[model samples]
Target: MSRYQQQSAAAAHVGGAKASTDGRRLRVGVIGLGIGRMHIEGWRQHPQVEVVAIADPDAERLAAVGDAFAITARHASAEAMLGTEALDVVSICTPNKFHRPLTLAAFAAGCHVLCEKPMALSAAEGREMLAAARQAGKRLMINFSYRFSAQSRALKAQVDAGVFGEFYFGRTVWHRRRGLPGFGGWFGTKALAGGGPLIDLGVHRLDLALWLMGYPKPTWVLGSTFDPIARELAAKSGKCFDVEDLAAALIRFDNGATLALEASWAANIGEAELMETRLLGTRAGLLQHNLDEGYRFDAHIFMEQNGAQFDLHLHPEAGEAPSAMHDFAEAILQERPHPASGEEGLVVMEILDAIYASARSGEPVRIAA
Candidate 1:
């Protein structure tokens, strides 16, 4: 079978739904109270999910979130929660440095993991986490939240339906003029974040674009990273900053397609914030971009029929798209495949690893198949 055929079969394996053998709600435990609050809210949406416990190093923040969510079983650390609760699912919402260790701990406890983005500090760690999940026979999913948007879902449907056939070129980017998160925190620390905007903000856009393009294998990447602005800002503010503020890459895929990716936490640009992804295919070209410098987004398709130029804009209905946690809950309860599986997350990690390597070496980095 061809690669696309294999991908289709794998997707089918995960997409087919089955009824639960017994009607029992899945018990969940969340790690970290920052983004973990959102995870709790999403999991609560599903009737079959019960958030039983929570873990956070910050006792005050943990108590506040746990009380706000009405979850009584709160622990000071993930190890404590994993040791105490009989949770069937665990969500890791901590820093990039903690994802692999926390995910491994959850899997060792025989729980499925819903890990936050950038999978791990590197592809090597991501592979270890994936192997552990497989050994434990549990689902491992990454929170690529951008892909869960209504506009993105609609575009994915169209792409799968052959609306844009054989994507050959693409561009995905996210930039901010001066919007670094937690400027003095771990986000600015290379040891914690692995990298700057590329791993943090760019991962979402890159995943959205690559998923739309069917995630073709990347062959090589030529990339560059810069931190002049962030370093200067850190010096002036007397804050610690060691990661790049801007990064760009040219990636070549195995299917003869090419993608250009750019990300920045600080840049001298007209827009305060900008995010976009465009895929040029043989049949049609597609564009998805944020509107009003906010989370809201819209899509458009460019095509020609009978020698006439045609432009069609998508009108995605307004509704809250199912959260990644909600989808994970349904997948577990219905015995279906997890969305944004570990394998896909590993693929993203591999590309990211290459981008960083290329940036450091000042040459193209080749990915090993």
Candidate 2:
């Protein structure tokens, strides 16, 4: 079989066949009261999901959210909630360090999981979570919401159709100016949030690029990370900071494609915030960028016939707002596979691990086969 055929088979394997159901609703429990509030709201909107319980270390936060959502089943900890609440699924929105443990615990409780992004601190942790889900005969999903964007899906369709034939190089960037998150909060702490922009923000773009490229195996990576902005900002705000403010990496795939990734939180750049990806191919090129207030995407296909150069612009239809929680609910209810599975999240984490390793060692790091 050809490479495209192999990719199609693999995609089918990861995304299992859709199973019909009797339209019964699934009960969901959400952990971590911070971003867990968003998950609760999203799940409530789904017709096939019911918010049964909520858990948080902060009783006040949990009570506030539970009251707002009119939910009486609330617990002070995820362990306590899981033991009592009969839930079909759990949303793990805790800190980075706790993702693996929380997800595994949820799986052990016989609940499918919808985990927040970055999956875990490392690929190994992601693997363990995946294993737990498999052993428990449940589903594991990662909430990489960017891939659910309309433009992203449209771009993937065009690429798979060979509209941008033989794509060679791509650039994915997420830059922000003076937007250090949470100042000196847990977001800036290395122990709580892993690395900086690369893992937090760049992970989205990195996953988008790799997914568009059909999740090819990465060969090697060379990268660099800086903490200048975080140090200066922390000094001014009088808070502890121990993560990089800026990071960049060059990743080469086994298919001979190269990706240039750039991410920053305090870079002196033109845009206040930028999230964009540009793909260059043998036949055409594509660009998707987020501008002021909204987003812009352009596709260009070039051809030379009879010594005349021609370029065609293809415009895509507008997309709807995507909710990872809602998608997870529908997937569980319909017995369909989710777009962002545990294996895909592991690939993103593996690349992240390699990027950090390369930045620290000042040498090219090879991805294990």
Best by lDDT: 1
Per-candidate Cα lDDT values, in order, are 0.87, 0.81
Quality of model 2 by C-alpha lDDT: 0.81
**97 in model 1: Cα distance from truth in Å?**
0.4
- Runs in model 1 with CA error above 4 Å? 1-22
**Structural similarity to truth (TM-score) of each candidate:** 0.94, 0.88
TM-score of 2: 0.88
* Sequence-dependent TM-score of model 1: 0.94
Residue pairs in clash, model 1: none
In order of listing, the candidates' clash counts read 0, 0
> Which residue segments of model 2 deviate by more than 4 Å?
1-20, 293-317
Candidate 2 residue 76 Cα shift, in angstroms, is 1.7
**Model 2 agreement with the true structure over 1-369: per-residue lDDT tens digits:** 321121101211222223347878788999997777778877877877899999998989988998999999989999999999988889998888889999999987878888988899889999898888777778888877677666777778888898778778999998888768877677788888888889888998898888887888898999999988778768888887888999999999998999999999889887877888887888777777774713454444565556787775555556454577777776666656677888889988988999999999999999988
